[model samples]
Target: TQLLEQSPQFLSIQEGENLTVYCNSSSVFSSLQWYRQEPGEGPVLLVTVVTGGEVKKLKRLTFQFGDARKDSSLHITAAQPGDTGLYLCAGGFGSYQLTFGKGTKLSVIP
Candidate 1:
């Protein structure tokens, strides 16, 4: 099974600061997806990277897939309090189930 490990399980920052979080796995995957979950809601899909070394940006957020497709990173620029949530990374290996990371909890203080 491919297990994704996330760094700095918890993060706290003041609003307008920038932060970067990472997800890594020892096994390679066919595709990787990033998600964010709020208090009482299911995770919302943020982005999906299928090609190695692919980079995608969503406003102030940027995502990149590793060259070998075994890792990914998310960077938030000038973060706001609304950006607080649990970030998760899931890897697909052509199976019905996806291997998911434990997630990184973030709190942006206003």
Candidate 2:
């Protein structure tokens, strides 16, 4: 079984601050995806990292895959109140199913 652990499960920051959340696992994954969810809505895919050491950026958000493919991180710059939400990392394993982390809940106070 594959399990993913996310660190600093809860985060509270003022608007315009920065934050980083992490995900780690002992199992190797074919791909990793990041998602953001708001109240009463399903998570929205933010980015997908495949190759080791790959990095993707979307506006103020950045995503990175570990060199060994066993971990990933998400960094947000100058966060806004609108950025407050639940962030999740999902790993794709051999069975083509995704094993998700507990998720990081972020609160950006304006």
Candidate 3:
């Protein structure tokens, strides 16, 4: 069975702190997507890195796809209260069903 395992499922940090979340799997993936969700709202796509060793940055956030395409990473710099949310990683092709990670809940305090 395809599965994505995420680490440090819960995180709380003060404003201006840095944090990193990880997604790992034994199966190789074609692509992976990162999403952030708030209460009462669906997850919003943060980024998708298809190629191996690819890295994309959004503001203070950075996403990296593993060389084997079976793992990924997210790093946030100078986190703010607005960053508090649930972070999810999905692995698979868009045309196919994606397997989601357990999710990481982040809380950024002011």
lDDT tens per residue, model 1, 3-48: 8899779999999999999999888888999999999999999999
Query: What ordering of candidates by TM-score runs from best to worst?
Result: 2, 1, 3
The alpha-carbon lDDT assigned to residue 45 of candidate 3 equals 98
lDDT of each candidate versus the true structure: 0.94, 0.95, 0.94
RMSD of 1: 0.9
- Candidate 2 structure quality by residue, lDDT tens digits, 1-110: 68999988999999999999999999998999999999899999999888999999999999999999999999999999999999999999885889889999999999
lDDT digits (tens) for residues 64-97 of candidate 3: 9999998999999999999999999999844687
What TM-score fits each model?
0.96, 0.97, 0.96
Off by over 4 Å in 1: none
lDDT of model 2 at residue 72? Answer: 98
TM-score of model number 2: 0.97
Clashing pairs in 3: none
Q: Estimate candidate 1's alpha-carbon lDDT, on a 0 to 1 scale.
A: 0.94
lDDT of 1 at 2: 66
